[model samples]
Each structure stands twice: as C-alpha cells, then as structure tokens.
Target: MWFSKFFILLSVWVMLSIEVESSTHWIVTESGLIQPRLNSPFDMERPYDLLAFLNQEKRWDAIFENYNDLMKHQKVIDALWFDVGEHTNSGTQILQDKDCEKAGNINAIDWHASILDDGSEKVPQEKYLFPSAYHGPSTDVPDCKRISSLTFSMFAFEHLESMMQRDNLSANPEYVLPELLTPIMTLDQFGHWVTGVLRENSSSWLHYHMASMFWRIRGNAPKALECSRRAVHYAPRAYKDIALGSLGVVLHRAGKSNDAIIVLSAAIDHDPTSFVNYFAIANAYSVIGEYNTSLKYYDDSLKLNPGMELLMRHKYGVMCQAKLSLRIKAIRETLNKLRDELNVYTQKQEAWTKLQTEFLKTIKNGEETIEKKAFERMSADNCA
Candidate 1:
C-alpha cells in the first residue's frame, strides 16, 4: 500500500512540473519590445513605485495648490477637472441593510433605558439628519506627474495633460462634470498650455529612460533616440547597463544596427546575466545577416530563460534562414559544375567531328569500295 501511494504521488508531481514548465507568459509592449509578463506586484520596479507615490490624495491636493499659485503670476489656462461619482447604494439603504434591528435610531438600544429614565418628559426631539449619498471627490485627476519643490505644481499639471493626450481619455463621457463647474479646457488648448512642460526632464536618468519608452510607443524614433542617449549619459555606473540596453534598442529601431551592436555589447559586459540584453544583441546581429553570431546570442539568452517559447521561436527562425542560405550556395556550386562539364563535352564533340571529316577526305582519293568499308568499320568502332 505504501509503495502504491508513493508511485501515485510521484506521477502527480511530474504532471505539475510539466504544467509549470509550459505556462510561461509573454507580453509585447506598445514600443514593440517583447518581455515576460510579471505575475505579481513583487516583480514591479522603481518606475511603478514612483507612479504609485504620485497617485495619493495628499499629492493631488499639493499639486492643485501649486497650480493655483502658478495661475496668479502667469496667464496660465486652467486645467480641466472631472467630477466622477461612485455608483453605490445610498447611505440610508446601507444603514438599513447593515443594521436592520436599529435602522432608525442614532444610538444602540439599552435594555434598562426605561427604568433609568427620569419621570420628567423629554424635550421635543430635533429632526435626525440622514446620511447623504456617497460621491467621489470632484477634485480627482488621473495619476501622472512628478513633484519637485521649485516647479512641482507646473510639472504636475503638464504631466497630467500629457497623460490625458497619451491615453486619449480627454472627453470620455463617463467622467461627467458638475453643473456649477466652469473650467473650460479644450484639447488644442492643452497642447498650447503644456508645450514647454512636455520637454524631457533631465533631472534624472530614469526620467529620460521613461521618456525614451514613451517616444518609442508613440513611434517617434528621433525623439526616442535623443532621450535614450541622455539616459545613457546620465545613468549611474551601477545602473548604466539598463540605460545602455534601452539606447541599443532605440538605435536598432532607427536602423543603426552596427551602433546598436556596440552599445548592447557594453550592456552585456556590465551585466552578463541579463537575458534581455542578449536577446536584443541577437536581433541586431540578425538584422546585419550575421547568423552565427545571432544564433550564439540567442542561445545565451535561452540558457538564462529556459523553456521560453518566444526565445525558442526566434532561435528557430535564425536557424531556418541560415539553412536556406547554405542550400542556395550548394545549388549555385552544382550549377557551375554542370556548366563546366557541358563546355568540355561540346569541345570534344567538335574535335571528333573534325577528325571524321579529315578521314573521309583521305578515303575519297583511295580505293572507293575498300576505303568505304574501312571507314564504316572505323565509324562503328568509334561509336561503340
């Protein structure tokens, strides 16, 4: 019985192992980079952390105060605000449903209240105020932007506008404006308002890197290249590989494959364990028809991220191309050999015909019957 149970458990374990090995998921970003999808929040990095910090209610209040202050000095147009409301049960209904027994009373019931009460009649009770229906804050804005002490509010406003344009969320009817709200802002006006603010902030290398990604997503190769170069220039030594990898990708996208290879090689030297760097360099090599080098890098990347289907697919594609090139070369060689043999055979046939003509001419002056028979025998021997 114990042996049978052990065999069954082993079989189950093998099945689970197979399932896990086959369940790799990949995502292609808007910028055309392929990456493995992270399954948990723990896998999130610094960029996501910055985004979360900027999303707090307190941060929004600070940004609003800053924007209001900016409006005093400059002829700045007001930012549009949406009054989004929550769809939920009314407060009264919530109270009724949550506390059915004491729904109408403000205080909980006391069993000895009647005994404890004095003989005097209580003064007329004031009308109880029912809780108002719940609504989302009217000052709410989409999460975007960074806060700095000097120009925090201005940057925040521009970031918000840019995000709205990037996401195409402006004029989305789901966020209805309150009737009394009167801040009129148009999409064209947003473009005019945030022109200077939309320039890439050079304060942090991470910011430039993020800007590069944004430009890539927008299909702006030149801007992406510029931002990536700045990112590489400003990145710290420890994090330089990250910036270099991004720069390489931008260069590759810009059709500078040789330059991309050089940058990606530096990235790989900085961090050999990074599979993404290997994968990127492999693609660059593939672009230049360096199949052997491309295959080597692809193999290296696959070694780091085993069982990745996308990596395998890329490696197989390169292998197919290499094989087709070899076959084409072999076919060319065979055709050349056939042509050479045909030339040699043609020359030999011409020489043989000339010799036969000379022999017939010699036989014409000799005994006609005897020479004819001799010539016929010679012809038969030559044919054989």
Candidate 2:
C-alpha cells in the first residue's frame, strides 16, 4: 500500500515537472547553444482555466475577458516561451469570431459549449498570432498582414457576415452553432510550436465535417459533397471513410447515383473488411435499380458476416419486394386453385383473407423500397 501510494505521488510529480518544462523547441548548433534557464511559468489551459473561471451568464463576454487577460500578460513575462504574431496563430483566431457571428450570442467556448466552423472562417487579413511573449528569433510571416483585424476580433467585420460558410454545421438538433467554431487569431511563432500545432490541427478545415452534414440535411448536396471530399483527401484515411460515405450519399440524393457508386467503391477499396462500406455500396446499387447488382452486393454483405441476421433479413426483404405485384397475383391464383379442389368455401375465404393481409403488409412496410424494386422489375420485364 505504501509503495502504491508512493508510486502515484511520483507519477504526479513527473507530470508537474513535464508541464513546468513545456517548451519543446530549443536552439540547436554543433554545441548545445545556451543552458536552459527558468521552468515555464506560462501554462495556458491551466492559468486561465477558462472552464473553471469563466462561468458567466454572457459566456462570450467571459471568453473575451479571459482571453484578453491571458494575452495581456504575455508581453511582460520574462520566463515566457513563445511570442504572439497575427498569421501564425491566426488559424485559431477566427474560432471565437465565428461563434459570436453565428449565434449573435458571444458565449461559444464558455465552459460547456463547443464551437465549429464551416468553409467560411472569420479569417483575419494579417498579423495573425495568439498572445505570447518573445524577445529574439521571432519569425515574421508576410501572409499575416494580408487580412486585417478590426477591433479585437480578427477578419473583415466591416460588413456583418457569418464567420463560417453555410455548409459547416451538423443537422443534429442537440448541437448549437457555438459548438463548432470561433474567431481567427494568430499565435507567436516561437521554437516552431505555434506552426506545428496549427498545421497539425488543419485549423482551416475545422468544423468541416459538422457543417457538411448540416448542409446535406438541407438538400444542399453539392456543397456537402465538395466539403466532405476535401476532408477525405486531407484527413487520415481511416478517419476519412465516413466522409467518403457521406459524400456518396449526398451524390446519390442529388441524382448523381453513378458518382455515388464511384465514391462508395473507393470506400470499399480503402477498407474491404468494413461492413459499412459494403452496406453503403449496396444501398447505392439499390438506389440505381440495379437489383442484380444489389443482389451481388447483398451476397458480398453476407460473405462478410453471414451471421448478421439483420443484413440477411434485409436481403430477404428486398427479394420479396422485387417481384412483388406478380407474386401477389400468383398467390391469389394459387389460393383459388387450392380452394377449388377442396370445394371448401369457408377455407377459401380464410386463405384469401390471409393472402390479402400479407400482400397489404408487404406493400405497407418498406413500401418505398419494395415499390421501387417492383418498378425496376416491371420495366425490365416489359423490355424483355
């Protein structure tokens, strides 16, 4: 017990030591450049403690005050590690701006709220960087100056405009506008930390998935398809499969079923083991009225998981629905023949009732999918 307690204490101590020595970049030459000095006193998430400290009725006001405070101290701290510049940190700057613009409510990132961005960012013209202290070796990037900041908020706010493009939103009602985005701000480029974090974040693409889904729900398929396609291209391939599937669905809905097929096929190529890929492709094929192709995909789905009773049942459901109207007529005829042989009027009545009930049920449940498949079979049979 003593040993376990001691071990836990040791771990905590190690974490504190690491946090205290937060700066990752160091000047390197043939000789170890300069002896490192003070332990880092500037902890961003901890010192501000936005989640803990800022619990105001007006959340945006709290965020502005807290951020203003954090940046305010950067210029004076002697032991500070990084510097503030406009472009370098600009990637994260618009996060706040977007929230304020979207809600007209400023409290986007306070405590519980999450914010997102779409294509349109509250992009600042220049001088993008977050507040940080620096003396020497601060990199000057000219792109920062291209966009200008008005007041404390970055980006061109001359006209009242949305911070994010219309596409970047989630359709889920649980989400609010603030959950995904904010104003653009730049951070100081020091020891490569600022650029490293921002680049990895792909801040420009922030809230992209959320917004794309929103646009998709509104039948704005073109924008959804384009945004998700970009996300799939730039994001890690494993994480990008959903984007591909979503893009495929948007295409399918917009009457671009062939394009939908191509996109889903790419998903299959990406992960043959994924049942989601098979199902999505199967759905696309079903949409195109290629039942033979749909059947083939159902076969593929079964191969992936024969025990998936759900998929198997869905396949059976499709089969029943495919040649439906003819099957219904045939059932009626077969019932008549059985009743004629038996010459049992009462039995015939019951059989007829059962048949009609089943036919109605089939036509009722999955009526759309079944009807669509029936139309395909009807068209093909007519051509034959």
Candidate 3:
C-alpha cells in the first residue's frame, strides 16, 4: 500500500512538473541565440572556418552557440595568434601547455605605470587577446593609427573588412572583432573603432547600438541616449523589439520616465514574453511612484524568470514599500491621537495654573492676617 501511494505521488509530481514547463513559451528562433544542445547538426565533428561559417544561413546568431567549439578550431586560433611570439603570463599557462604561439614581438609595456618603464611593469600578452588600436581624429597619431589598423586587420582578417563594406549590419550579419577585442582593447580604441564603423555604415544600427553601450559605460548619458534612439530608429525588424527595450532604459536614464514607460510598454507589445521588457516597464512605473503598477509588472517578469535575484529584490522592495505605506498610515493616526491628547493636556495645564495662582493669593492673605494678630499680642504683652 505504501509503494502504491508513493507511485501515485510520483505520477502527480511528474504531471505538475510538466505543467510548469509547458507554461513557459520558448520560441525556437530566440532559443537559437543560446548554445545548441549536443548531437545537433551545428555540432558536427568537422569544424568551420570563421569567415566561411558566418556567411551561412541563420549562422550569425547560431555561431556563438558553439564558442567552445570555435575556440578549439585550429585555423581560428592560428589566424588570431599567428603573430604572438613568446611573452606568456601566468594566465597563459594553459595556452603555453597547448603550445599556442606567444606574442613575442608584442611589447610588454607596463600599463599601470602610465609610461613604459622596466619590463617588470609590462603586462604579459595573451594569445587570443587583441587590443583595440583604433585611434580617431582626436588623437590621430599617424604611426599609431597605422599600427592599430595593421594589428586589427591582421587579427580579425577579411571578416571585419567585409563588414566595413556593408551598409546595414543588423540583417543577419557577423560582428566578431568588437566582441573579441572589447575586453582587451582600451576604451578609446573601442570608441574609435565604433566611430569608424558608424562613419562607414551610418545606417548600421549595430554600430550605433555598440556606441550607446560604450558611452553608457563611460558615464556619458546624453551621448548614450542619442545613440540608443538612433539604434532604435534604424534597427531591423529582427532586432526592433530588443532595441526598443534598450531605448526605454536609456530614456529612463535621461530622466524621461513617461517616455520610457511608453517605449517599454510598446516593446512588450512586440514581444510580450520578454521578461526584460516587463522589467524595464516596471522600473519606469516605479520611477514615477506608481508602485502598485510597477509591482504588477514586476510580478509578471518574475513569473517569466522566477530565479532572477534582481527581480526578486525589486519585488521585495515593492512589497516593503506597500508595508511601509500601511505603517506610515498607522504612525500618522497614532501621532494625531497623541497630538489631540497633548492639546487637551496643554489647555488643562493652563487652567490649573490659573487656579493655583488664585489659591496661592488666598493663602498669602491669610498668612498676613495671622502675622498682624501676632504683632497685636506682642504689643499688649509689652504694655502689661
């Protein structure tokens, strides 16, 4: 009987689990952005060339799914690190073990010192890391620009060169160098490269999108807002919803809470299931003191991604505000009662003071009369 009951419970649990899973609507198109499962067609034994592979169908988004696989590809590694001679840091031990080419010619300059000093201060170069060397007209050192150009071209190859030729990069295009070099590149170089991309393809929302992110990181809210708006305006249909969501956030940062709410709400119309849109709209509502509406959206977003710690915190905060509102009301009521009692006590204290003064005057008069009688008795005794 126990075994039978356990089996019945297990069946019920399985059904409930399936129901929960089914409630989440996972779009295959959106899922393609994530890593493909093993044994999939994209996970073949034979690897693909970086340039050649990206030119394939829906592969631009799908390729990132195989980042580990791409890292192991010999051609991709050789293409990236063909120039790294022998300057390996402690971090490069794994690469050294793998016999990857070290960046010997790449100078180990001490970035911490602000000026190149002893070689000890110099950072040891990694194999895969490509520093952004692009410098724009503002800091246009001809020789440095030339070197930066050569270094980037050599590192990224014809992939970037081809992208530079394109007008619109948002339409199933490949943008690899920025992702690969952003971490290793100086902020100036990244900005310069993004600027160059924008100049070459002004219509490319991708470059503008990147510029918005770069400026935002640098704490330039106005520039970030401008770029974010431009990106949203020029974004392709595939990226429109995401761009709208980003624009909404930038609007919020620009102190346009109402616009942010409207934009984010519209973004939700485009992709209702997107937790980020719900989250952004909720934040906009929260900024305008619409706590209840914000809490509702927050709950909706939480339903989509229940485990998000940030969302949980936001929900908790809204609940705290709601609780605080009640607490504030109770405190106000208590304060009002105390104030009324204080007023009554103040009036009674004033009346009591008046009565006490009259009583003191009467006692003083009686004391004077007793003193007079004592004086008369003293005079009679003296006469006797």
Question: What local distance difference test score does each model get?
Answer: 0.47, 0.42, 0.48
Model 2 segments more than 4 A misplaced: 1-207, 302-313, 325-384
lDDT order of candidates, best first? 3, 1, 2
Q: Which candidate is the best by lDDT?
A: 3
The sequence of per-residue lDDT tens digits that candidate 2 reaches over residues 1-384 is: 875555445434434555232222122246643211222111112322333212211332232344334434433332122222222344344334432233232222211111122222223423234344434343532121111111322211111121123234222222433223222321223323333333445433223444355455434544554445444554456545555665555555555566667776876776676565576567567656665676677679789777675555545544433444234455566555544544443444455445334333322233343345335545755698
The TM-score obtained by model 3 is: 0.43
For each candidate, give its TM-score against the true structure. Answer: 0.41, 0.32, 0.43
* 1-384: candidate 1 lDDT, tens digit per residue: 875555445434433454353223234479764333453111223322434322322332333344334433232211111101111213334344432322233233211010101101221212111123323233322111321212322211223322223232111111222211112433222222222223433345554554455445445555544555555666677666776776666566556667678878988987787788788888888778898999999899999989775566667666655554555555565555546655654565565455434333322232342244345545755698
Give the alpha carbon lDDT tens digit for every residue of 83-186 in model 3: 22221222354323221222121123111111101111112344112334433443321112222222222211113322233222221112233433355455
Q: Note the residue pairs that clash in candidate 3.
A: 84-102, 84-103, 85-102, 85-103, 85-104, 86-104, 132-185
